[model samples]
Target: MMRILLLAVLLLTVACGTVTPPIDIAPDAWISYDHKTSYFVSDAGADSVRLTVKYASFTFLDKSAELLPVAKSVFQRISNELAEKRGTVRAVYDSSKFYESVAYNGVSGVSTALVSNELTFSAKADSSGTPTSAIEPVEIVQKLEALKKALDSGLITKEEYERKKKEILERY
Candidate 1:
């Protein structure tokens, strides 16, 4: 009976270990909006811009272990907009997208290369300009909602949620 219990515990450990946590943008990430574009820069650094959406409803994926389609679309749109605005964009390091490239590609050869490449290039292009302090109130609300979702999903602790909430509120 002891051996059987040990085997069950080992199996549980292995099962839990295999489950990957969902990906979320940082609470302290910077958001900058200019005209029609809204840039959600990664808190990690200027190297990565988490999401850039233009005139669209941004939805949060529940319990998603991989980068969701909506998120990809936002990134892709940002890339296109950057190319249109600046004529060209240079590449930069992006850890989250890099992980997605490796993990997502391995799961299903449907490459997320475009999302990574576009964001990297755009980050470099946008880094040159000064971000405006003025951001749309709607955008701020959306970001807060995203953070709240992260908290609800157990991706962030209550303390983290409050801290991030305060930081975001201070922006406006």
Candidate 2:
């Protein structure tokens, strides 16, 4: 009986040792963000003056093992968006979209939540100008419409369409 128990213990140990390790085991890592704010505005200052708006700071965490795939998928989507426009583009994370997350502790085998956060981004700009506040939302809608049209027309590929569509829909 003792020998059988020892054999069982050894088998269990071998099974445990053969399990795949989690990709990210560290507590801290470098992060990057696509946007600073989800919302942007342009205010009119003078006649025909363009107001350039900027968003706030965003943080990216490199420690999320599960979220890594989600993050990369989002990034690839954004890159596709930029590739379509042939113009400068930026993406930001929707803080409102952030959901609670949980992770299994490697050492304890217990589930733990490593706080989740939001990130946002804006296209790089050099000049600062004011935009008519009244038309800002209208302009955004028109832009979205244009993007949709581009997708339908095949000017932007399907993958690009899906990504940009998701990005825009997240705004609403």
| Top lDDT prediction, candidate number | 1
CA lDDT of each prediction against the hidden true structure = 0.46, 0.39
For residues 1-172, what per-residue lDDT tens digits would candidate 1 score against the true structure?
9999999887665433221212443535525444323444343344434333322221222123343454455556555565446444432333344333211222222312112322433322235554334444555788899999999999999999999999989887
Which consecutive 10 residues in model 1 have the weakest lDDT in total?
Answer: 54-63
Model 2's TM-score against the true structure:
0.20
lDDT of 2 by residue, 1-172 (tens): 9999999887665433211212332223313334421111222232111111112221232223454345445434543353234233333343344333333333333322222223222343333422112223334677789998998888999899779867766654
Model 2 misplaced regions, further than 4 Å: 1-135
The clash count of every prediction, one per candidate, is 0, 15
